[model samples]
Target: MVLGTSFHFDGQGTATAADAMKRYCGLLGEQEMEGKSSPQWLATKELVKDDGEMVFEEGISRFCPNCAKILKSAVEGTYPRLI
Candidate 1:
C-alpha cells in the first residue's frame, strides 16, 4: 500500500513507522510483527549508531512517538525531538 501523505527518508531510512518496524525486524512486507522483538535490533540499541545509518527506529511505538522523530534525525544527521 502507498502512503496518502507525502513522506520521505533516505539511505535505508524507511518511509513510515510501520515500514521502519519491518526493517528493524528484518521481516518481509508480507509478514506480521508477531508481537516479538528482534535480538539483532536489541543489540543495535547498545550503540550510539546502527551501522552508522540510524539511531533507534521505533522505541515501542505505543509508548514513544519520539522514536519516529529520532529515526528521522538519525538519517538527516540532526537533533531530534519528541512530539
Candidate 2:
C-alpha cells in the first residue's frame, strides 16, 4: 500500500487532487495486477479547515476492467464514458 504525503489545499486545488488520485490509482492498480490479484485500488482524502477540524472525508475504489478502462479512456478516448 502506498501512503501519500499530506497536502493542504483550499479553493484552488481541484486539478491537483484529481491528478494525485489518478496517479495513486494507477500505481495501486498496477501493483495489484502484478501480485496476480484482481486489480483494485482504494483512496482516501481528508479535508479539513484551517483549525484542523474534519470538514469532509471521502473514500474511492476501483476494480479490474473498470479501473483499467477509466484510465485508458481518458488517454485514448476509445471507451464510451459512463453516465
Clashes per prediction?
0, 0
Tens digits of per-residue lDDT for model 1 on 1-83?
A: 22222223345544554445445433312222233222222333422433323224333343345345444543454532222
Model 2 agreement with the true structure over 1-83: per-residue lDDT tens digits: 22233434444453333345454445534534323322221211221233111111121232223454433333343533222
lDDT of 1 at 24: 48
Off by over 4 Å in 1: 1-55, 80-83
Query: Would you estimate the TM-scores of all the predictions?
Result: 0.23, 0.25
Cα error, candidate 2, residue 67 (Å): 7.8
Worst 10 residues of 2 by lDDT: 51-60
User: In order, what is each prediction's RMSD in angstroms?
Assistant: 11.8, 13.4
Give per-residue lDDT, candidate 1, residue 30: 20
Worst 10 residues of 1 by lDDT: 28-37
